[model samples]
Target: MRRRLSIVLTLLTVMMLGVIVTGLSFGEPGAAPMDDYFIENSQSESGANNVVTAVLFDYRGLDTLGEAAVLFTAALGTTLIFRRRRDD
Candidate 1:
């Protein structure tokens, strides 16, 4: 009985995962909506030669920096957790 239950649960979990993956939103691989003014203004306002660079590195710099910080913090946490504890 226990073995049958385990197999049923495993199959159910696999089917659920397949359903979720199949329902995911994966549209055209690469596309952009760039009105020329939006790009030109973004470049000049953010003070970078490239508009995309300005948008990513200037306007969104804080978010990028935060992502880096979070990654660093997670890595540090994981390392500390797995590291050998000192007894001395």
Candidate 2:
């Protein structure tokens, strides 16, 4: 049983290593058209000098807000859980 388990684990490890090597060899992906659009119009449309800032704050404001809300909720929950309760 132990020998079979060891063999199975070794084979899985080798397979995973081969997959990683293959993925790395593919290199960087080609840029999408949306990337070019953002680069060209972010400044004019969003009125933000920085492309990244424009995308996060103007173009994708709602998505960014949702993410912030989730993070804030998580932080509040964590604080509530760890806070001390006063027993009078």
**What local distance difference test score does each model get?**
0.83, 0.92
lDDT of 1: 0.83
Clashes of each: 0, 0
Candidate 1 local lDDT, 1-88, one digit each (tens): 9999989999999999999999999656335455455576886687788777887788789998999999999999999988998899
RMSD of 2: 8.6
User: What is candidate 2's lDDT per residue for 1-65, written digit by digit as tens?
Assistant: 99999899999999999999888844355357888899999999989999999999998999999
Q: Which stretches of candidate 1 lie over 4 Å from their true place?
A: 1-22, 26-38, 85-88
Candidate 2 worst ten-residue window by lDDT: 23-32
Please name the candidate that would achieve the greatest lDDT relative to the true structure: 2
- Candidate 1: C-alpha RMSD to true structure equals 6.4
Q: Which residue segments of model 2 deviate by more than 4 Å? A: 1-30
